[model samples]
Target: MSNPYFQFKQFTVWHDQCAMKVGTDGVLLGAWASVERARRILDIGTGTGLVALMLAQRSLPDAKIVALEIDEAAAGQARENVARSPWQERIEVVQADFKKYRSSDKFDVIVSNPPYFVDSLECPDRQRAAARHNDSLTYEELLEGVNRLLAADGLFTVVIPTDVVDRVKAIASMNKLYAIRQLNVITKPGGIPKRTLIAFSFSNRECVIEELLTELARHQYSEEYIALTREYYLNM
Candidate 1:
């Protein structure tokens, strides 16, 4: 059986009750997102509140973070994880679908490691499938929510499979959210990029492109990857 919890440098995430557990994708999105000066943040489809906690640790002490999860079990576990973290007071876990969610106040930064499998076979486990497949939250719907809740200068960031990068960018453009930065995530030194991290904003700026090699070899992490995630990983 998988471990019930993942212990980070500053926080512990217990994911036994969550459909999706703490994994590299969530960690990468949480660590790679630029949260500098963000006074208010939102994490959509937060499975175990990992990204929310990480953002809380990175953002200003006065920053407030809201983690939205559609699944009841996952949202409850996220709340439990947040309650145990140092930033309990700063993070709020809300059980709600992002597409139908509403907020009076806009967010300075919005991040998500959303369900991206658009055409793949669904997992037999209904909850796991919803957490991984985009049927529960399509890119169009996700971007629509970001467009509605984002501040004028706010940024919406997400990590998705490389195959869907272009499609997502097109959708973002349709919503008037232009790509500002992108990071290609390669698993090994010579491997093809499997995921791309993108940040979108209201203004059309020159997109800054960068590459991140996660590992030099099997079990050997790259310096850049280690450096980016060292703050949260317990043994990095």
Candidate 2:
């Protein structure tokens, strides 16, 4: 059985109520997102609040973050996890849909592991289906919401399947966001990229593409993956 909670060096995430548990996609984005200068950050679909907590550990002490989760139970669980963390005061878990969420303050950085399976079959579980499928939150709506709260020069980063990267980029461009950098992630050294870590901003420029190999061989973690997430994963 999967563990009910994920224990990080800095905090623990109890995901019993979350549709999505602690997974690699979330971990990669949380570790790869550039937040060195971020004063305020926002995490859409916070889930077990993993990304928000990771950002809290990465940013300065005074940096504040808001974690928005549409699922009420997951949001409550995120709040509880944050309350039990070291930076509880620096992070707030809000229960609301990102498209409907209103905030006067602008964010320096926005990140998400959004629902991307638009053409896939639905899962049996309602919550998991909502969490995994685009019906719960479409790319258009996600970008529109991001555009509304993101500062003119802020960075918006997300992780999506390699096949869907183009579609997501097209939507982001429509919303006036442009890609700046991307990290194509491969499961093994010789495999095709399975996911892409993309970073975008309002100001468009020459886009940069890079690759990250997660494993050198079967079940053997790659050096790059270990370096990126060493701070969080206990066994790393």
Candidate 2 lDDT at 57 equals 94
Off by over 4 Å in 1: none
Q: Estimate, for each residue in 70-133, the C-alpha lDDT of model 2 and write its tens digit.
A: 9988999999999999999999999888878999999999999998778988999988888898
Q: Pick the candidate with the highest TM-score.
A: 1
**Backbone atom clashes (below 3 Å) for every candidate:** 0, 0
* lDDT (tens digit, per residue) of candidate 1 on 113-231: 99977899989999999999999789999998899999999999999999999999999999999999999999987789999999999999899999999999997999999999999
Residue-level lDDT for 162 in candidate 1? 96
Location of the lowest summed lDDT over 10 successive residues in candidate 1: 114-123
Give all candidates' CA lDDT scores. Answer: 0.94, 0.93
